[model samples]
Target chain A: MDFAPTPEQQALREKVVRFARDHLGARAAEHDRDATFDESGWKACADFGVLGWPIKKEYGGGGLDPLTAIMAYEALGEGCVDNGLVFAINNHLFACAVYIADHGTEEQRRRWLPALCDGSLVGAHALSEPETGSDMLSLTTTAVRDGDGYVLNGTKKFISNGPRADLFVVFARTGGDDVAPQRALSAFVVPADTPGLTARDIPKAGLRGTLMGEITFDGCVLGEDQRLGAEGAGYQLFTSTMEWERGFMFASQVGVMSRLTDRCAAYAARRRQFGRPIGSFQSVSHRIADMRVRLELARLMLYKVGWLRSRGRLAMQEASMLKLYVSEGLKTTALDAMQIHGARGYTEELGIEREVRDVLAGTIYGGTSDIQRSIIAGLMGLPTAA
Target chain B: MTDDIAKTVRSFIGEHVQDGEPGDDHDIFATGSVSSLFAVQLVMWVERTFGIAVHPTDLDIENFRTVNHVVRFVESRRAAAAPA
Candidate 1:
C-alpha cells in the first residue's frame, strides 16, 4: 500500500532527471529536422550511466531494481525533450539488453552484458518483417541448423536502432510446419557484423533521431551458443518478455504525458486571450485537466506493473492495459497541447508539432492499441480473434 | 491430492477449450483447443492455485502441454517445496 518512493529511489529519480535535462536533447531540433541519431547525446547518457540503470552491477550496470528503474526512466522522459533519443535508449535497454539478462545462459550474460552496459555496443530487437507485423507466429524468417551452427535468412523492417546497433536479439523459425505453432521459432543474439547481415535506413515522420531501418540477414551464420533460450522456445520467450517491452518501455510515455500537461498548464496560465489568461476559459482549462487526469492514471498503472515485476510476478494483463492506456493517453495529451497552444503548437517553432508526430507512433509500435485491446480481451477469458 | 489438482486443472482448461472436453493427455496446443496465450495464463494459474513458483527454466512447453503434465508439474513442485 505504500505509494511513495523510498528516499534512495527519490534521490535516483532526481539525479536522472537532472542528468537528462543537462546532458541530453541539446540537438533535438537539429536531429529531428535532419532525421539523424544524436551520437553526442548517446555518449553523454553512456557516460552518465543512463544506459545501464536496470542491469545487474556485476555486468557493469547500475543494477537499480525494476520499480526504481521505471521511476528513473519516467524522470528521463519528463526531463529529456528529445523523444526519439529516449525511444532509442528504451529499445536498446528494454528490448535487447534485458532479453539477454533475463533469458541468456550465464556464459551468454558474461559475454554480452558488460559491453552493452558500457555502451561499447548498441542493441535492437528484430521481430517485425516485411510480411509480419502483429502475426509473429507467421513470421517467415528461417534459421536452418548447420554443422554446429545455424544459417539465418530473413528481413526485419521497422527496427529501432537497427542502423547503428552492434547486436540484435532476433526471432526466427527453427522448427518446421509440423511443429506446434507455439514452439516453431527460436531466439538468437546476432551480432551486426555477421557476414550476411546488412541494414538500410528507413526514415519516418517523428522519433526520426532513432533511425528506424530494415535489416536483411542473408545466410548469416550463427554459432549454437548464440541461441538465447532453448530451441523451439521463441514464442514462449517472447510472451514472457513482452511485459518488459510493453510496460517499462512506455514509462517514458507516461513521463511525456506529464511533460506535455505541465507545459500546457504553464502556457494557459500566461498566454492571454479576450483580455484574460487562456486558463480562465473553461474549454482550455478542461483540456489541461483531462491531460492531468490521464497522467496520474497512467503513472499508477505503470507503477503497478513495475511493482509486480520487481516481485517476480506475472504482469501480462496489467502490462497490456498500461501499454494501451499510456500510448493512447500521451497521443491525446500531445494533441490537446497542440490545440491549447493554437498557432504555436501547430508550427515548428514551439516543437509541439514534433511532440504530436513522436507520440503518433506510440500506439503503433510495441503492439498497436488495437492489438493491446485484443490481448486484454483474451486475458479476460473472452474469445478473441488473436 | 492428485485427483483434486487434476480436477481443478481440467476445469480451468475446459473453460478455454472450444470443442468437447479433452482427455488427460490431449495436446491442447497441437489440437488448437486454446490459443498460445493460454499457455501463459495456465502457468500463472498454476502458480496462483498451487502456491508454487514457475521459474524461467520451467518454461518448457512439456511442463504444461496437457492436464497430465500440469498435474505432474504441480506435484513435483509441491514435493520439492515440502519440509524434509
Candidate 2:
C-alpha cells in the first residue's frame, strides 16, 4: 500500500541516474544510428554491478531485495536514454541469469554463475522460432536424446542478446502428445561455441540496441547434463518463467512513462504558440496529464506483483496485467512525447522516433498485449474476445 | 546461520529459472536463464529474504555482482536493521 522508497533505495536511485546520464545519454543516438552494442558501456555496467543486482552472493550477485531492485530499475529507465541498452541488460539478467540461478545443479552453478555475474559471459534466451511467435506449445524445435547428449535442430527468431551471447537457454520439444502438447518440451543451457549453433542479426522496428537475431541449432549436440530441469519439464519451466518476465521485464517501462510525462510537461511549459505555452491548451495539457495517470497506475501494479511474488504468492495474472499495462502505457507515452515534440520527435535525429519504435515492441514481445489480456481474462473467469 | 534466507533466494530462483546448475554465474541472464521481468521480483526477494532495505544505490549489477554478494548484503542489512 505504501509506495515511498526507503533511504537505501533512494541512494541507489541517485547513483544509477547519474550513471545513466554519464554513460547511456547522448551516445544513445549514436548507438541507434550505428546499431552499436556498446561493449564498453556494457562492461562498465558490470563494474558498477549492474549485471548481478538480484543474484545471490554465492553466485556473484548484489543481493538487493525485489521491490528495491524494481525501484532501482525504474530509476535506471527514467534516466537512461538508451532504452535499447537498458533493454538488453534486462534481457540478460532476467532471461538468462535467473534461469541458471534457479535450476542449475550445484556443479553447474559453480561453473557458470560466477562468469555471468562478473560479466565474463553474455547470455541469451533462444525460444521463439521462425514458425512460432506466441504458440510455444506448438513450437517445432526438436531436442532428441542421444547417448550422453541431445541433438538439437531448429531455428529461433527474434532472440534478444543473440549476436554476442556466449551461453544460451534453449527450449526444444523432447516428447509430448498432441492432447497435452507441452509434455515433450525441455530446456537446455548451451554454450555459443558448440559447432552446430549459429546466430545472425535480425533488424527490428525498434529497441535497436538489443542485438536480436535468428539462431539456428543445426543438429547441435549438448551433454545430458546440459538439459535444464528434468526432461519434458520445458513446458512447465516456460510457463513459470513467463510470470517472472511479465512482472520484472516491464518494470523499466514504468520509468519510461514517467520520463515521457516529465518531458512532455516541461516541453508544454516552454514551447509556445498563440502567445502562450502550448500546455495552456487543454489538448496538450490533458495528454500530459493522462500520461502521468498511466505511469502511476502502472507503477502500482508492478509493485503489487513484486510484493505478492516475494510473499510466495502465484502472481501470474498480476504479472500479466502489469506487463500489459506498462507496455501499452509506454507506447502511449512515447507517442504523446513525440506528438508534443512535433518535428523533433519525428526526426531520427532527436531519438524520440527511436523511443516510439522501441516501445512498440513492448506490445508484441514478452507476450503480446493481446495475450496478456487473454491470460488475465481467463484467470478472472471473464469472457474474452473471440 | 539459517540457510533460511539463502534457501529463500534459491527457491525464488528455482521457481522461475529453467533447470540448470544452481550456481552457474554465466548461466543466469545470458542463457535465457531468467525472464527480463525478474528485476522487481529479485528486489522484493532481497527485501524479504535478508530482512533489510535495498538502497537504490546498491541496486545495479554491483550489489548483484554475485550470489554471494546478495547473501552477504542481506545478512549485513538485516543485522544493521536489527535493534541492538
Residue pairs in collision within model 1? none
lDDT of each: 0.91, 0.78
DockQ per model, Cα: 0.45, 0.03
What tens digits encode model 2's per-residue C-alpha lDDT throughout A1-386? 66787788899988888887787656787787777687877888888888888778888988877777777788888888888888888888888888877777887778888888888898888889888887786788998888889999999999998987899999999874532343468899999999998989988777777799999999998899898877876766676666667888888888888888988899899999999999999999999989989988998998888777566555666788899889888888999899999998899766789889889989998889887877666454343332
* Runs of candidate 1 exceeding 4 Å displacement: B31-33, B47-58, B76-84
The worst-scoring run of ten residues by lDDT in candidate 1 chain A lies at: A377-386
Clash count per candidate: 0, 88
lDDT of 1 by residue, A1-386 (tens): 99999999899888988988888888898999999888898888888888898999998899888899999999999999999999999999999999999999999999999988888899999999999999898999999999998999999999999999999999999998788788889999999999999999998999998989999999999999999999998998898888899999999888889889999999999999899999999999999999999999999999999998888777888999999999998988999999999998999989999999999999999999999998888776777664
CA shift at B7, candidate 2, in angstroms? 35
On a 0 to 100 scale, what is the lDDT of residue A47 in model 1? Answer: 84
- Report the alpha-carbon TM-score of model 1 versus the true structure: 0.96
How is the predicted docking of candidate 1 categorized under the CAPRI scheme?
A: acceptable
DockQ of candidate 2 against the true complex:
0.03
